[model samples]
Target: MRVLTILLCLLLTGTPARAVQPDEVLPDAALEQRARDISAELRCLVCQNESIDDSDAPLARDLRLLVRERLVAGDGDREVTDFIVARYGEFVLLRPVFGLHTALLWLGPVIVLAFGAVALVRGARRRRQEAGTPALTPEEKARLDAILGQD
Candidate 1:
């Protein structure tokens, strides 16, 4: 039973199935690796969340082929990536480049965090102030005492 469980775990956690076909694999090992690396960084437009390497979508296949084609054409990694970015826009990149255009994407989290921290600090200060002092003024307290005495 333990051996069966171990086998199941190994099968489940083993290398994930890739979408790359045997025909799609380049003969040149180095170029094929580069193509694969590039494919892994490209987002599949159809899948939206999956990389081209993992997605079975036709667009992902096209992108994979395009990457291989670019490699075969002697384009460097950066050049191939630039070409894809130009053709498909930066949204196709799994990891987007930080620049003026993508500034919000890169900085929005930090900005939100900073704003939340400021709000938290302000909230803590307000809570401390409230805890330190009486909620009512001296006159109000005197009025309350008089009312209670009358009652």
Candidate 2:
């Protein structure tokens, strides 16, 4: 039982294996680290949600190679990222930059939440108004009392 528990813990805590191939590693450690960093920020177009560094897709591999190639050719981190963004139209970034064009993306949820809260408040007030009982006139009250007395 102890062995089973230990094995289960080990399996659960194990680090995820990177998808980078042996041949794709750069000869320079600095360049390789930079390449790794850049790949980590890039989303795999084929896999949709997975980072290029963690995706095993062919397009992910190609993008990894492109980052390394750009790094080797003396391009800075920003330059490599910009080049890729230009080609892929910003969808390739794991986290997109906020700008005027992406204002809706950033503020849409807040706007929806505000509208929902207002509607909820209005609905509650409306229900309260509708639930109130109207006051009976003196004549109606007398009639009701007379009917009860007859019963």
Candidate 3:
């Protein structure tokens, strides 16, 4: 039991649990560099926030391979990117294209900030109005004064 426990610990120690993407062995350094550049601009669909080059997902590996293949096949950078974009939509690009469909993506945060600002202004105005109003009525104040035996 002690030996099994020691073996298990040794096996599990310092080994990365995340699966690594397949390394593309490019014939030319320049082609590999281009592939890396393009991959860096592509977002991994499985890991939405991570670039395809950085993600360990199987899908990311496939996309990385696809990019390298296209590069080796003499496709220009723009052509390779366009091919992926056409296949996966603008979501594949780390920075999406500006178009009617993506207007919301570009404007969403600004719209939210504007709405929050309006809400804050309205809330502040409401608070000011409430603060200016007397908490107790004149009659109530008078009653309280009388009850307390004060003028």
Candidate 4:
């Protein structure tokens, strides 16, 4: 049983998944650096939370290649980004532009936090008001006293 468990664990954990090959790397260090920089800022559309540089998706590799190609073609960083934005809207950027279209993306978290603070303050105030109210009538107080007296 122990050998079977070990075999199962090895089967699950030991196999190496396919990743990008070393031969696919760019020969130019400067282009490679530019690719890395651009990839770091670009969101991987397939893996929404990860940057293109860190994502293993084929689309991420394509984006990396695109950035490198643009850099090699004498385009500046902004030009490369502009090209991508033109192709895939502003949503592809990790830090979206500030405009009517993207204002909510920039402000959504702040608005939620402000609302939460207001709600929390109101709740605490309500609790305090309830706590400060008179505890009991004379009869209720007498019953409470009697109950305590027994203890």
Candidate 5:
């Protein structure tokens, strides 16, 4: 039981294996670190939600290589990111930039919610108004009562 517990603990506590292969590692520690930071910000196109740093997909590997290449070519972090964004479109970044182009993406849900709330309030008010007043006129009420043999 103790051996099993120890194995379980090791398994749970072990650091996750990185997807970057040994051949892909940069010689310069600083550049490698920057590449890692950039990779973490980039979405793996094939893996959807996973960052390129964590993804094991072939596209993720290619993206990692591209980042290293850009860094070696003396591109600044922003420039590297922009290059990727230009090639893959805005979806390459895990967090999209807030700008005129993306304003609708950021605000669309709130706008939809506001419209839904207005429609809901209007519908409730209409239902309440409909339910509050009786439809029968005095003559209609009298006729209904006479048909039911009520004096």
Candidate 6:
């Protein structure tokens, strides 16, 4: 019953556990909100699949603090994001910007889809041709006649 109740409560609350400690929160609400927004855009290096705001890893905590520090330093959202990207490279961004460096990353899925579609069309055509009729050679025709006792 306890476990069931606990699961029920967890299902009702969908937000993931945040890594931010109370001490890391700024007194300024607006600055804290900006820091949170920035943190949400950052990928946690220790947990590549999670945003720094959602990850509970130590590196995620550090990243959250760094975002808060940048906000406190009066840096705008873009400036803070660029500063982190400059330091960590583009991998730190959860949503990578499209550019020459990331062109393959952006286009690879479309290219694969196109190739898959072409292969499906070719396969369907081959199956259709095979299903249509048997193109028998002269020797095969004689063999068929022998098998049918018509030779």
Which window of ten consecutive residues has the lowest lDDT sum in model 4? 15-24
Rank order by TM-score, top first?
6, 1, 2, 5, 4, 3
Better of 4 and 6 by TM-score: 6
Question: How much lDDT does candidate 2 score?
Answer: 0.95
For model 5, residues 1-151, the per-residue Cα lDDT tens digits are 9999999999999997789999999999999999999999999999898999999999999999999999999999999999999999999999999999999999999999999999999999999999996899999999999999999
TM-score of 1: 0.82
Relative to the true structure, candidate 2 has a C-alpha RMSD (angstroms) of 4.7
- Give lDDT tens digits, candidate 4, residues 48-118: 77888777899977887787788889999999999998998887999888999878888999999999999
TM-score of each model, paired residue for residue: 0.82, 0.80, 0.68, 0.69, 0.70, 0.82
Which 10-residue span in candidate 2 carries the lowest summed lDDT? 142-151
Cα lDDT tens digits for candidate 1, 50-151? 899999988899999999999999999999999999999999999998999989999999999999999999999999998896788988988998989953
Q: What are the lDDT figures for the candidates, one per model? A: 0.94, 0.95, 0.87, 0.82, 0.96, 0.92
Better of 1 and 3 by lDDT: 1
Ranking by lDDT: 5, 2, 1, 6, 3, 4
Candidate 4's TM-score reads: 0.69
How many collisions per candidate? 0, 0, 0, 0, 0, 0
Off by over 4 Å in 1: 1-12, 135-151
Instruction: Summarize candidate 2's per-residue lDDT along 18-86 as a digit string, tens digits.
Output: 999999999999899999999999999999889999999999999999999999999999999999999
